[model samples]
Target: MPKMLCRCGKVVGLGEIPSSNQWMIISDTMITDEDWDDNGLNMSDFYKKMDIVVKCPECKRLYIYSKGFGNEPEVYNLEE
Candidate 1:
Protein backbone atom coordinates (compact mmCIF):
# COMPACT_ATOMS: atom_id res chain seq x y z
CA MET A 1 0.00 0.00 0.00
CA PRO A 2 1.13 3.54 -0.75
CA LYS A 3 0.96 6.34 1.75
CA MET A 4 0.79 10.10 1.15
CA LEU A 5 1.94 12.79 3.51
CA CYS A 6 -0.21 15.87 3.63
CA ARG A 7 1.18 19.36 4.15
CA CYS A 8 -0.77 19.47 7.38
CA GLY A 9 1.30 16.54 8.67
CA LYS A 10 -1.48 14.04 8.14
CA VAL A 11 -0.80 10.65 6.60
CA VAL A 12 -3.19 9.03 4.15
CA GLY A 13 -3.11 5.46 2.88
CA LEU A 14 -5.33 3.23 0.80
CA GLY A 15 -6.59 -0.24 1.64
CA GLU A 16 -7.83 -3.36 -0.12
CA ILE A 17 -11.30 -1.93 0.18
CA PRO A 18 -11.40 1.84 0.03
CA SER A 19 -12.27 3.61 3.21
CA SER A 20 -14.26 6.82 3.61
CA ASN A 21 -11.36 8.96 2.38
CA GLN A 22 -10.67 7.10 -0.85
CA TRP A 23 -12.41 7.85 -4.12
CA MET A 24 -12.03 7.36 -7.85
CA ILE A 25 -12.60 10.08 -10.40
CA ILE A 26 -13.68 9.46 -13.96
CA SER A 27 -14.22 12.15 -16.56
CA ASP A 28 -17.69 12.51 -18.02
CA THR A 29 -16.22 12.47 -21.52
CA MET A 30 -14.59 9.13 -20.80
CA ILE A 31 -17.93 7.44 -20.26
CA THR A 32 -19.75 5.93 -23.21
CA ASP A 33 -22.50 3.40 -23.98
CA GLU A 34 -19.84 0.92 -24.90
CA ASP A 35 -18.42 0.98 -21.41
CA TRP A 36 -21.66 -0.43 -20.02
CA ASP A 37 -23.62 -3.43 -21.22
CA ASP A 38 -25.81 -6.30 -20.08
CA ASN A 39 -22.78 -8.07 -18.68
CA GLY A 40 -22.48 -5.37 -16.08
CA LEU A 41 -19.62 -2.87 -15.84
CA ASN A 42 -16.10 -3.60 -17.00
CA MET A 43 -14.34 -3.05 -13.69
CA SER A 44 -10.85 -3.68 -15.08
CA ASP A 45 -11.24 -1.14 -17.86
CA PHE A 46 -12.95 1.32 -15.53
CA TYR A 47 -10.13 1.15 -13.06
CA LYS A 48 -7.59 1.92 -15.74
CA LYS A 49 -9.43 5.02 -16.90
CA MET A 50 -10.03 6.46 -13.47
CA ASP A 51 -7.79 8.56 -11.31
CA ILE A 52 -7.30 8.07 -7.58
CA VAL A 53 -8.18 10.66 -4.96
CA VAL A 54 -7.51 10.49 -1.26
CA LYS A 55 -8.53 12.91 1.45
CA CYS A 56 -6.74 13.38 4.71
CA PRO A 57 -9.21 12.95 7.55
CA GLU A 58 -7.33 15.11 10.02
CA CYS A 59 -6.50 18.11 7.80
CA LYS A 60 -9.00 17.51 4.97
CA ARG A 61 -6.42 17.91 2.24
CA LEU A 62 -7.09 16.35 -1.14
CA TYR A 63 -4.40 14.34 -2.92
CA ILE A 64 -5.13 13.86 -6.59
CA TYR A 65 -3.49 11.03 -8.52
CA SER A 66 -4.00 12.14 -12.10
CA LYS A 67 -0.61 10.79 -13.17
CA GLY A 68 -0.94 7.58 -11.17
CA PHE A 69 -0.04 6.79 -7.55
CA GLY A 70 3.65 6.10 -8.34
CA ASN A 71 4.22 9.88 -8.58
CA GLU A 72 3.46 12.64 -6.12
CA PRO A 73 -0.12 13.77 -5.94
CA GLU A 74 -1.44 17.19 -6.83
CA VAL A 75 -2.57 18.60 -3.54
CA TYR A 76 -5.68 20.65 -2.96
CA ASN A 77 -6.65 22.41 0.23
CA LEU A 78 -9.98 23.67 1.41
CA GLU A 79 -10.36 27.39 0.77
CA GLU A 80 -12.93 27.94 3.40
Candidate 2:
Protein backbone atom coordinates (compact mmCIF):
# COMPACT_ATOMS: atom_id res chain seq x y z
CA MET A 1 0.00 0.00 0.00
CA PRO A 2 1.20 3.50 -0.79
CA LYS A 3 1.01 6.07 2.00
CA MET A 4 1.51 9.82 1.97
CA LEU A 5 1.31 12.58 4.56
CA CYS A 6 -1.59 14.94 4.15
CA ARG A 7 -1.20 18.70 4.42
CA CYS A 8 -3.41 18.56 7.48
CA GLY A 9 -0.79 16.39 9.19
CA LYS A 10 -2.75 13.18 8.90
CA VAL A 11 -1.38 10.11 7.25
CA VAL A 12 -3.28 8.98 4.17
CA GLY A 13 -3.70 5.31 3.18
CA LEU A 14 -1.91 4.23 6.41
CA GLY A 15 -0.91 0.87 4.87
CA GLU A 16 -4.55 -0.10 4.57
CA ILE A 17 -6.98 -0.20 1.70
CA PRO A 18 -9.06 2.92 1.16
CA SER A 19 -12.71 2.04 0.87
CA SER A 20 -13.91 5.51 -0.18
CA ASN A 21 -11.04 7.95 -0.27
CA GLN A 22 -9.29 6.59 -3.31
CA TRP A 23 -10.60 6.77 -6.85
CA MET A 24 -9.52 6.10 -10.42
CA ILE A 25 -10.35 8.75 -13.01
CA ILE A 26 -10.62 7.87 -16.68
CA SER A 27 -11.21 10.35 -19.45
CA ASP A 28 -14.29 9.77 -21.60
CA THR A 29 -12.18 10.16 -24.73
CA MET A 30 -9.81 7.46 -23.54
CA ILE A 31 -12.49 4.82 -23.73
CA THR A 32 -12.72 3.19 -27.14
CA ASP A 33 -14.69 0.49 -28.90
CA GLU A 34 -11.83 -1.92 -28.17
CA ASP A 35 -12.30 -1.38 -24.46
CA TRP A 36 -15.98 -2.23 -24.72
CA ASP A 37 -15.16 -5.39 -26.64
CA ASP A 38 -14.33 -8.00 -24.03
CA ASN A 39 -11.99 -9.89 -26.34
CA GLY A 40 -9.88 -6.80 -27.02
CA LEU A 41 -9.85 -5.16 -23.62
CA ASN A 42 -6.88 -5.25 -21.28
CA MET A 43 -7.67 -3.80 -17.87
CA SER A 44 -4.05 -3.62 -16.77
CA ASP A 45 -3.16 -1.47 -19.77
CA PHE A 46 -6.23 0.69 -19.27
CA TYR A 47 -5.48 1.32 -15.63
CA LYS A 48 -1.96 2.51 -16.41
CA LYS A 49 -3.32 5.35 -18.50
CA MET A 50 -5.81 6.48 -15.86
CA ASP A 51 -5.30 9.14 -13.21
CA ILE A 52 -5.75 8.68 -9.47
CA VAL A 53 -7.25 10.90 -6.80
CA VAL A 54 -7.24 10.48 -3.06
CA LYS A 55 -9.20 12.44 -0.51
CA CYS A 56 -7.86 12.81 2.99
CA PRO A 57 -10.43 11.37 5.31
CA GLU A 58 -9.35 13.52 8.20
CA CYS A 59 -9.24 16.93 6.60
CA LYS A 60 -11.26 16.35 3.45
CA ARG A 61 -8.41 17.66 1.34
CA LEU A 62 -7.94 16.26 -2.13
CA TYR A 63 -4.72 14.96 -3.65
CA ILE A 64 -4.92 14.76 -7.41
CA TYR A 65 -2.39 13.02 -9.57
CA SER A 66 -0.77 15.00 -12.37
CA LYS A 67 0.87 13.02 -15.16
CA GLY A 68 3.00 15.96 -16.27
CA PHE A 69 4.46 16.77 -12.86
CA GLY A 70 6.09 13.46 -12.00
CA ASN A 71 4.94 11.42 -8.97
CA GLU A 72 3.97 14.07 -6.48
CA PRO A 73 0.25 14.70 -6.30
CA GLU A 74 -1.24 18.18 -6.67
CA VAL A 75 -2.98 19.23 -3.47
CA TYR A 76 -6.37 20.92 -3.30
CA ASN A 77 -7.95 22.01 -0.08
CA LEU A 78 -11.67 22.12 0.27
CA GLU A 79 -13.28 25.52 0.17
CA GLU A 80 -15.60 26.57 2.91
Candidate 3:
Protein backbone atom coordinates (compact mmCIF):
# COMPACT_ATOMS: atom_id res chain seq x y z
CA MET A 1 0.00 0.00 0.00
CA PRO A 2 1.16 3.58 -0.63
CA LYS A 3 0.99 6.41 1.89
CA MET A 4 1.15 10.14 1.56
CA LEU A 5 2.16 12.81 4.05
CA CYS A 6 0.17 15.96 4.35
CA ARG A 7 1.83 19.34 4.80
CA CYS A 8 0.59 19.18 8.38
CA GLY A 9 2.59 15.97 8.85
CA LYS A 10 -0.51 13.81 8.97
CA VAL A 11 -0.10 10.40 7.37
CA VAL A 12 -2.67 9.19 4.84
CA GLY A 13 -3.10 5.81 3.18
CA LEU A 14 -3.78 5.90 -0.56
CA GLY A 15 -4.77 2.27 -0.84
CA GLU A 16 -4.74 0.69 -4.31
CA ILE A 17 -4.57 2.50 -7.61
CA PRO A 18 -7.91 3.50 -9.06
CA SER A 19 -9.49 1.89 -12.12
CA SER A 20 -8.92 3.06 -15.73
CA ASN A 21 -12.29 4.80 -15.77
CA GLN A 22 -10.90 7.22 -13.19
CA TRP A 23 -7.89 8.09 -15.30
CA MET A 24 -7.60 11.44 -17.08
CA ILE A 25 -5.98 11.52 -20.49
CA ILE A 26 -3.58 14.22 -21.49
CA SER A 27 -4.08 15.80 -24.87
CA ASP A 28 -1.24 15.13 -27.31
CA THR A 29 -1.33 18.65 -28.63
CA MET A 30 -0.46 19.89 -25.18
CA ILE A 31 3.00 18.33 -25.50
CA THR A 32 5.54 19.38 -28.06
CA ASP A 33 7.98 17.06 -29.88
CA GLU A 34 10.95 18.97 -28.51
CA ASP A 35 9.72 18.42 -24.98
CA TRP A 36 9.10 14.75 -25.70
CA ASP A 37 12.51 14.26 -27.30
CA ASP A 38 14.22 15.89 -24.36
CA ASN A 39 12.42 13.57 -21.97
CA GLY A 40 12.66 10.57 -24.28
CA LEU A 41 8.87 10.39 -24.37
CA ASN A 42 6.48 10.77 -27.30
CA MET A 43 2.79 11.60 -27.61
CA SER A 44 1.99 7.91 -27.79
CA ASP A 45 3.71 7.42 -24.45
CA PHE A 46 1.41 9.91 -22.75
CA TYR A 47 -1.55 7.57 -23.12
CA LYS A 48 -0.08 5.32 -20.45
CA LYS A 49 0.12 8.15 -17.94
CA MET A 50 -2.66 9.27 -15.58
CA ASP A 51 -3.37 11.61 -12.70
CA ILE A 52 -5.03 10.61 -9.45
CA VAL A 53 -6.68 13.17 -7.23
CA VAL A 54 -6.21 12.74 -3.51
CA LYS A 55 -7.29 14.76 -0.56
CA CYS A 56 -5.69 14.97 2.83
CA PRO A 57 -8.29 14.02 5.38
CA GLU A 58 -6.53 15.99 8.07
CA CYS A 59 -6.10 19.33 6.31
CA LYS A 60 -8.37 18.92 3.32
CA ARG A 61 -5.56 19.69 0.92
CA LEU A 62 -5.90 18.20 -2.54
CA TYR A 63 -3.05 16.40 -4.24
CA ILE A 64 -2.40 15.20 -7.76
CA TYR A 65 -0.55 11.90 -7.96
CA SER A 66 1.08 10.15 -10.89
CA LYS A 67 3.65 7.39 -11.47
CA GLY A 68 5.18 9.03 -14.56
CA PHE A 69 3.89 6.03 -16.53
CA GLY A 70 6.73 3.91 -15.16
CA ASN A 71 7.24 1.30 -12.49
CA GLU A 72 8.76 3.34 -9.71
CA PRO A 73 9.20 2.91 -5.98
CA GLU A 74 6.93 4.44 -3.40
CA VAL A 75 7.46 8.12 -2.84
CA TYR A 76 6.60 7.85 0.85
CA ASN A 77 7.45 5.28 3.52
CA LEU A 78 5.05 3.55 5.84
CA GLU A 79 4.87 4.59 9.47
CA GLU A 80 6.40 2.20 11.97
Candidate 4:
Protein backbone atom coordinates (compact mmCIF):
# COMPACT_ATOMS: atom_id res chain seq x y z
CA MET A 1 0.00 0.00 0.00
CA PRO A 2 1.07 3.57 -0.60
CA LYS A 3 0.86 6.44 1.83
CA MET A 4 -0.25 9.93 0.93
CA LEU A 5 -0.23 13.21 2.81
CA CYS A 6 -3.38 15.27 2.95
CA ARG A 7 -3.63 19.02 2.69
CA CYS A 8 -4.27 19.15 6.44
CA GLY A 9 -1.00 17.34 7.18
CA LYS A 10 -2.68 13.98 7.76
CA VAL A 11 -0.90 10.95 6.42
CA VAL A 12 -3.17 8.20 5.13
CA GLY A 13 -2.69 4.91 3.37
CA LEU A 14 -3.94 4.75 -0.18
CA GLY A 15 -5.71 1.44 0.39
CA GLU A 16 -7.34 2.54 3.59
CA ILE A 17 -8.95 5.59 2.11
CA PRO A 18 -12.63 5.56 1.18
CA SER A 19 -12.94 5.36 -2.60
CA SER A 20 -16.61 4.60 -3.04
CA ASN A 21 -17.33 7.94 -4.69
CA GLN A 22 -13.86 9.08 -5.64
CA TRP A 23 -12.73 6.64 -8.30
CA MET A 24 -13.23 6.18 -11.96
CA ILE A 25 -12.42 3.08 -13.99
CA ILE A 26 -12.31 4.02 -17.61
CA SER A 27 -11.88 1.53 -20.40
CA ASP A 28 -10.50 2.38 -23.82
CA THR A 29 -12.67 -0.10 -25.65
CA MET A 30 -15.78 1.35 -24.10
CA ILE A 31 -15.16 4.85 -25.36
CA THR A 32 -17.31 5.77 -28.31
CA ASP A 33 -16.99 8.62 -30.82
CA GLU A 34 -19.61 10.59 -28.98
CA ASP A 35 -17.63 10.27 -25.79
CA TRP A 36 -14.46 11.21 -27.63
CA ASP A 37 -16.15 14.19 -29.25
CA ASP A 38 -17.51 15.26 -25.93
CA ASN A 39 -14.06 15.21 -24.37
CA GLY A 40 -12.21 16.23 -27.56
CA LEU A 41 -9.89 13.28 -27.30
CA ASN A 42 -9.28 10.07 -29.22
CA MET A 43 -9.65 6.55 -27.88
CA SER A 44 -6.04 5.67 -28.35
CA ASP A 45 -5.02 8.76 -26.49
CA PHE A 46 -7.44 7.98 -23.72
CA TYR A 47 -6.15 4.43 -23.43
CA LYS A 48 -2.65 5.66 -22.73
CA LYS A 49 -3.92 8.17 -20.23
CA MET A 50 -5.80 5.88 -17.89
CA ASP A 51 -5.37 6.53 -14.19
CA ILE A 52 -6.93 5.98 -10.79
CA VAL A 53 -7.90 8.78 -8.40
CA VAL A 54 -8.45 8.57 -4.70
CA LYS A 55 -9.57 11.28 -2.34
CA CYS A 56 -8.27 12.20 1.06
CA PRO A 57 -10.99 11.93 3.63
CA GLU A 58 -9.35 14.36 6.02
CA CYS A 59 -9.18 17.43 3.80
CA LYS A 60 -11.31 16.29 0.85
CA ARG A 61 -8.32 16.53 -1.45
CA LEU A 62 -7.76 14.36 -4.48
CA TYR A 63 -4.90 11.96 -4.96
CA ILE A 64 -4.31 10.69 -8.46
CA TYR A 65 -2.51 7.42 -9.03
CA SER A 66 -1.34 6.74 -12.52
CA LYS A 67 -1.88 3.27 -13.88
CA GLY A 68 -0.96 3.02 -17.59
CA PHE A 69 0.14 6.53 -18.39
CA GLY A 70 3.71 5.37 -19.07
CA ASN A 71 4.69 6.34 -15.58
CA GLU A 72 5.20 4.69 -12.22
CA PRO A 73 2.17 4.03 -10.01
CA GLU A 74 2.79 6.87 -7.68
CA VAL A 75 0.40 8.79 -5.45
CA TYR A 76 0.04 12.50 -6.10
CA ASN A 77 -1.68 14.82 -3.70
CA LEU A 78 -3.67 17.54 -5.46
CA GLU A 79 -2.70 20.04 -2.80
CA GLU A 80 0.93 19.60 -3.78
Q: Model 3, range 4-74, lDDT digits (tens) per residue?
A: 56677987675556532122545577666776577656545665554554566666565544654233322
Q: State each model's CA lDDT, in order.
A: 0.81, 0.76, 0.53, 0.58
For model 2, the superposed segments whose C-alpha errors exceed 4 Å read 17-20, 68-70
RMSD values, in order shown: 1.9, 2.8, 9.5, 7.6
TM-score against truth, every candidate? 0.80, 0.73, 0.38, 0.40
Instruction: Determine the backbone clash count of candidate 4.
Output: 0
| Model 1: pairs clashing at backbone N, Cα or C within 3 Å | none
Rank all candidate structures by their TM-score, best first, as comma-separated numbers.
Answer: 1, 2, 4, 3
| Poorly placed runs, candidate 3 (over 4 Å) | 16-50, 66-80
Kindly state the number of residue pairs that clash in model 1.
0
| Model 1 per-residue lDDT tens digits across residues 23-43 | 899999988877765368868
lDDT of 3: 0.53
Regions of model 4 farther than 4 Å from truth: 16-22, 25-30, 33-49, 66-80
Best candidate according to lDDT: 1
The 10-residue segment of model 2 with minimum total lDDT is 12-21
